[model samples]
Target: MTETITFNDLGLSEGVLAGLRAVGYETPSPIQAATIPLLLEGRDVVGLAQTGTGKTAAFALPVLSNLDPYETKRPQALVLAPTRELAIQVCEAFEKYAAQLPNIRVLPIYGGSAYGPQLTALKRGVHIVVGTPGRIMDHLDKGTLDLSELRFLVLDEADEMLSMGFAEDIETILATTPEEKQVALFSATMPRQIKALTGQYLRNPKEVQVKSKTATAANITQRYLMVSYPQKLDALTRILEVENFEAMIVFARTKSETDTLAEKLRARGYAAAAINGDIAQNQREKTVNQLKDGSLDILVATDVAARGLDVERISHVVNYDLPTDVESYVHRIGRTGRAGRSGDAISFVTPRERWLLKAIEKHTRSTPAEMQLPSVDEVNATRLNRFDEGITNVLAEKEKISFFRDVVAHYVSENDVPELEVAAALAAMLHGEEPLLLEPEPVRPQRQSRDRDDRNSERGERSNRAGAARTNDRGDGQPMASYKIQVGKRHKVEPRMIVGALANEGGLRRADFGNISIRPDFSVVELPADLPQEVFDALAQTRISGKLIELAPDRGAPNRRTGERFQDRPARKPRRKD
Candidate 1:
């Protein structure tokens, strides 16, 4: 029989070991067990593991063991993540694992943050630089970040970077790093592009694959609830009331939605905060730390903003809006079920999103079991039970409750009032003006049959939801109008870049987009006919892949679109970069 290998058996340094022990890491996960040794032995490694499977510690531990904390004059290691949140997460993990080494400093640099602090950190001499590829590339371009002394380069979530349109940036950054540096790349899946990257960049790397049943970890209990769009907030509030979750993240689709939902949750008495791309970097970090330290219990966030957000206290993840793709679903739910803890991934599926559910099931090869929405009676029962339990808990602490009990008894004796009446008055005072019970949902009339006109409208709605908006290609005669943008394949543009820009700036639902096709020097996308002038103007000014959309209706002639705002404007010479 073979014995299990622990983190102690992995030949880590005294400082790293002390730090791990402090963080309560008693054993190594499968990926860590396999990859840490190779990293410590000065070998490049390619690791395959899903999110939330301890991949950070796998490479971070070994890197910490090898680096000299006193050598903080320049960065000895660089960790690249696909998103700001992920970069922050990796940086935090490194800081936690290097707790015993006080001299070691790690700085996370990403877009949406001011350059002053990052520049100060760089000038102060950081030991480790964790940042997204775009920000790293910008620093490299500005001649601020030098990689000549870097000893280790870890590409965490390499596949996600490529999928998010960082292929060129990754290559450019890799070109700047010292050739003598050891590379450690981690990704959930190895597509052809990632394989090509490994072949070109890594030198005889040791590959380790941790097999799993699905893209998401098995520890996550995946479920879906059927609800209408208007009722989603109500359903989520009810779930929060009944669910025994310690901490949770509720994912919304847009920045506005995140803020609105967080505000609503706070109003409902949940300690909540909001995070999205539009938020400042400091505020985002503060919110995440609040969630970690138990000061906050709920974080409402957008998908991009919550990428790689890992908090051990998070026991549940609620998908308030469905992700655009299956991979996003996996990534969003992956925030929970981390380490060895169990978690719940609950998604709300509107009737029109049934196709998305099917796509998820087909991709994961596991169906999300349907979850029943908590009924009014169930919520009322839970409330009453909690009320009773609160009293019971207070009574158990006799020393604390004796004063209140005496005051109540004295009031009853002074007024010669019934004990029950005084108790009811006290309960009313405690409960305040909030209703003690929730009203049941109103029933809707069922449609027994459909006329031709009703059927046509239904078909149109289905087409909008199920067509190119979800599939990335327009169907023939889909009743959608086409618009053109100046950025395309030549500009290294991606379909999602267009979707995200329009959705965020124009506030258009994902279903509003029709067909999206990328061409050589330009790209075209389908949108609803006769869009409001304000929405068109907003989209025309939106930027994608660092280029102003300069959008124009794909009128048979190649005239200007720019939402008619730039129709008379002279065609300014195209920028070199764009």
Candidate 2:
């Protein structure tokens, strides 16, 4: 619970303590506290911890502390990670924690980028090299990376590496290293492959497992708002207007999205900036410093860029987009609710991502309470309250108000207006542009059915269909409406493709659809009668394989009696005038 701890307890060097302080690391995490001592004793270590548990420091601290700064840079430390993202993250951590050690240099090598920079870094001699297996193997074969003098070899996220099919590559890299090298393997889980590797490579390793705390912070309140994509931005703006957050971090999935969302927030008058992989390191540090110092109120960032970032002033964490993994969700929310401080985490879950939200709740073992979108009246009430507070504070302060009073008098006289009119004009000016807040569209909740037999019967009929043509009835014994898409059998579209696209874009559950009829020209999907507007809007925006829905009504024989056409009229051509 405390951030500061004695490095002597961890058996680390004074120089390492100095370096840690330089990087603002006041204490060690549970994993770091247990593994650092054993690693500094020159014994192999096996650490089991989840992501964002300070696993990097668990290994990096001891490895850096034990290394002789005067030793020749022949790659004394080698760290292997699963992906390019993880490799870069570990290398950055090493660089930050070792900032005070002038002789310490770290290099990250990974694919999907150029090899020129990596080759240059290796040739210049680095004290530590963190890389992915494939790229590290490539460097080894090129004779560009020399690990014969390696004193420490670390396999970060060993389970993920194995899952990514890097066992052979790992073996090759380990074979190239010195047999007497101290090895440390860390993973979230120890599958059989990882255990076998440990038995073969690590010699009498000290095992350290840090179990996750079962209880989250009670002071931290969690809630989620069900919203459609078009309404999420509006909902977020409304929340920010009402919530009294000191500083907040909004998490998005991609770099581009972070930038875009930050710009939108700034346009709405909130002090905001984007922090992503594309931003320079210095700029990222400056942005964070500004947020801490109260110059900025909102920071939009992707997960990778925001990792290991601890800011005590962060009062809220908004998940602008649901994370793809449960681990990511934990890390995102962990940014707030620190040091016994109460915080709030709000997630906007679209209908399609409801399953992911459920997964997160199950993984965290804490269900987030659902909330409705804030109404316009609520936002206005909050604004009015803030205005009254501002006036009260001004009255309480011992500041000069004669100048403001004179200006108001002058304005009233020049416009030949009443004092109240002058005040109203001032308020309108203060509100700035876009004063009318838009109301968010409502989202309907999923329906629950208790009839298992009827549900299974409908599912069986859907599964047994052999062709792309079928008319299906709902589990409730009602005929569903069917619509055809322009793309069909010739488009190489499968029933599952249609199903997934609909589920993802249309926010429709798998049960909402009765059957999929795929054909050469297009496909037909069955839906409940009188579908909600939100569902219809989502379908209109759905894109499958680079094609828009372009859906027209499917007036099959069943609907002929209703006088409905099978296809809607095409867009009218403008009068072909000269």
Candidate 3:
């Protein structure tokens, strides 16, 4: 068994400590506490822990500590992840942890983005390269990414990479690396493929497994509110008006989103600040310190940037965007309810993201209570109650008020306004922009019966009947009308993506949609049969997966024969430089 340890006992350099302090990491997590020591001793390690258990740090700290800075940067450490999202996340963690280590650049290379920047960064010589297997292989083939000086090779989320069919690519890449390099592998599960890979590549690896625990703090009152994308801001504002939270942390998905949300919250008069990857380390530290000292009430942050943060004053954790994965959900909620304090975790789940919520519940083995959006009346009543309480507090304080009383009397006499009217005006001024509480939109849960049936149905029958069935009408007898959308297989969209986009952007429940037929260049969707022109127009304006959707009457043309086959489409024209 590995001995228990602390961050100080791990022998990390002062530069790493500075980075850790900037992020408020006072102690090591269980996984980090266990795995760092062996890895620091230059032993190959196989770590068994789920995401969000600080696995990144378990390997990152040791790698940074053992590296020789004076050595040429031909990629000393290489981390391979399955997806672009995971690759970026791991790179971000390394960057944040190694902030004070000058000349130790970390780069992430993935598809769905330009490769020029990645190539440039590689040519400049980065010490660590975290990337998806395909893109990394591309660089390796092109002679852009050099691993000649590599000392450590880490396979993060090994099971995920194998599931994504990167086994051959991983093997090929590992074959190119030097035999002297230390190998570390981490995975949530030890599947047969992962085990096989470990047996083939690892050298007497030290195994460290964190027992999966389904323990969530009893003090946390977890709840979730279902709302559409546009209504989310309004719903969140309403909740802020009603809930009496001391300090809160709002989690977003990206750096831009954090800033956008923070600005919106600030405009609404909340003491808010954003913390994301783009912010400088010193400024980020200052913001967190201010929040701890009660000067700032809310902090908006992304998951990677918020890692290692521990603040006792955070009374609530608001997931502004539902996490992309279960591990992220666990980490986001874990920000609150620390140090034996009771806290609240509130998530706003768009209809499309309900699946992710369910996944989180399955992984955490804890369900969040469903919460209804706060009504306008509820918010207004709470605001008035708070106002009254403030007045009471002011009155309770022993202070001579003769000067204020004289000034108010004079103003009332001079303006011929009632005392109540004067007080109301003052309250309005103090409240800033007149409080216009929004009416909460009615939330209808997505119907999962069809989805459940689809999952259980035989593949052959489901594909054959894809275009034949029609969804049941509501209380009315009219069958929903079928309309053709301009995007389909050519757009590389799946049924779930289409469903999620519609539910998120159009504010339509899953039940509102009927049979969906995906074809080469277009799709047919059953919308409300007698939908008003406004609804049709709204649907026309909707964009899904970043493609504008034009709605037209179904031509009764077989969806399969609508347009050019997806595989035969003309090559995309390259863009001109500005």
Candidate 4:
């Protein structure tokens, strides 16, 4: 077994040690254990670890051990992050670790905030500067940020920065910093570009990679619920009410969705908060702290905004919206099941997003078990149990209730009512107007049925056999309505792409679509006859090869005898397909 090391053994300065103790940190995490010694020696280092692996402290503690708070403040240390939220989070880590160290100033510079305050802070002199690449470049251009005397430079989530297309900006910033400044870089995945960056920027850096024991924590129980698009919000609410979770972080796709979901949860009496890119750094910090202290129970956040969020009490992670990619799904669920604690990861998979869900399963090498929404009666039972427990606690306080008991006695005597009736009236008064239970929702058809699998497999086989030109057959010997989409051979549109996009967009299985004939300008596809207006509308608005799927005008009826094919039409410039 590896030797256990604590914060005390890491050789942190007295001030940093005091701050770590204040934060209740005891032992060092795996990344911290391997990286602290290297960074403390002023050697350039590259750390490979995920978000919740305590990489921030792994870098921050050592940098603080070398930083001189009383020294000239021309930005002694610089940290660059991909997003504003991550930038603010790193800056806050510095502040917390430097709490006992006097005169140490750390400033977070990012876009979507006033430059006046950043300029003011810069003029006042700051020891460390943490910021996003784009905003940092803007400040560097204006000469508001000075990295001349910077002793340490750190890049948190370096791969993310490159994925966000900030490689050029990052290189420019690094070039401006003094070549002698100690550089430490951390990334979850080291792509070829990142390797090149390391070779160019880092000077024989000591590499530290602390691989997770498991792709997913063995303690986490993963499950998924399939619901229609319209009923997703209600499904989430029902799950939240019925599931016993101490704390949860609901992931949404956009900033506005996070706010909307949080508002709805709060209206339903949940202690919910929203964390996003638009929220101020101080407010975001306060919300996360509230979540940690048990003042808040649920936090709705986007992927970019929840980076470096490490809260021990997060018993559940609800994917209110499925992530766009498989890596994101893994990271979102990684927020929970941390520190060897058992946790739950629940995902809401809409019919249209089934492909994405399957992608997640394939990526993680584990399929989430199918879960059912709680019944109304079950939710009601939980509510009533909690209500009775609340009253029981009140009854235990008999001495404090003597005065109120007399008032109840007076009302009962004046109204000539039984004491039991008086107690019932009190219960009614306590219960608000809203019903204690919710209405039962219509049950949706299960997506994991054997019949659904057969349908998908059959569709895949038919598409494979049909090649590029095939007739529209609904598999039941019924004719399909042929439609033309604005992508074809020149655009590199394939039948699988068409099938996948249409099936996902229309919320239909692969078997629902028919043969696709690719032409020079456009392709002809056969879908179910008389498709629902809603499905048709969605298909029209959907893009196949970065071009909208448009309805082909009546080229007279499709020639059934010769099999449906697109007529000769003028081809446009070939557009690349993603």
Model number with the top lDDT: 1
Best by TM-score: 3
- 2 or 4, greater by TM-score: 2
TM-score of each: 0.57, 0.52, 0.60, 0.50
Q: Give lDDT tens digits, candidate 4, residues 199-310.
A: 9999999999986532566788999998876788888888887899999999998799999999999998999999987888899999999999999999999887897899
Per model, state how many residue pairs clash.
Answer: 2, 3, 1, 0
Q: Write the per-residue lDDT of candidate 2 for residues 306-420, one digit (tens) a residue.
A: 9888999999999998775566688788899888898999998877677567656755778899988777778888877888888788777655666788999988889889999
Q: Which parts of model 4 are misplaced by more than 4 Å?
A: 1-3, 214-220, 223-238, 242-432, 435-578
> What's the CA error at residue 290 for candidate 3, in Å?
11
- For candidate 1, list the clashing residue pairs, or say none: 551-562, 552-561
- Sorted on TM-score, highest at the top, how do the candidates line up? 3, 1, 2, 4
Query: What TM-score does model 1 achieve against the real structure?
Result: 0.57
For the record, the alpha-carbon RMSD of candidate 4 to the native fold, in angstroms, is: 13.0
Per-residue accuracy of model 1 over 120-187 as CA lDDT, tens digit each: 99998999999877678778878999888999999998987777667877898888889899999999
Candidate with more favorable, higher TM-score: 1 or 3: 3
Model 3 CA deviation exceeding 4 Å by range: 1-4, 7-27, 71-73, 141-143, 212-214, 225-235, 242-266, 271-315, 319-342, 348-364, 369-578
lDDT of 4 at 47: 96
Candidate 4 lDDT for residue 279: 88
What is the per-residue lDDT of model 3 for residues 1-578, given as tens digits with 9 covering 90 to 100? 96656587887888888888776677797788889889888899999987667788888888887877766558899999865556777888888888888767888886545678987887777888898776677787778888888899999988866654567678988989999999999998999988888888889998999955645677888999989688889888888888889999999987899999999999988999999878888999999999999999999999878888899989999999887656667777888899998999999987656655765676687899999988877887887687789988877765656667788899999999999998888777877766544455567656458878678668634432433223346555545756677888877756765664455434466777777899888897877654445344445535444355666555443348665322323222112222
